[model samples]
Target: MKEPRPDEWRAAFAREFQEQSAARFEKIGKQLQFKLARITAEPLPAELHELFKKKEKALD
Candidate 1:
């Protein structure tokens, strides 16, 4: 069996690293979206709700 050249090995390593990083980022993004959806779907505490409303008004 022939060993891979150094450049070939480096390219393969880089491709694998990018794939793993993208997968990790996607997993984190999904978790954040789920958490945000849960928080927004439920009733908020009065103070927090009021604070968000004020922030929203400021943005408008």
Candidate 2:
């Protein structure tokens, strides 16, 4: 078999970068889930709720 060219060797690094990115996102999701679960809900103030709605609408 022929040896891989430099680009072929570099392709493994690209796949590793993507795998690392996916791991980071999964970790963040788990952490956010844990944090949000611990929040006890009190009545959200109306102004804050309105601001949250506006932010949601802007994202949409």
Give the top-scoring candidate (lDDT): 1
Q: Which digits, one per residue and each the tens of the lDDT, describe model 1 over residues 5-42?
A: 99999999999999999999999999999999999899
TM-scores across all candidates? 0.70, 0.56
How do the residues 1-60 of candidate 2 rate in per-residue lDDT, one tens digit apiece?
Answer: 999999988998899999999999999999998888767445688999999999999999
**Best candidate according to TM-score:** 1
- Give the backbone clash total of model 1: 0
Enumerate residue pairs that collide in model 2.
none
Stretches of candidate 1 exceeding 4 Å from the true structure: 48-60
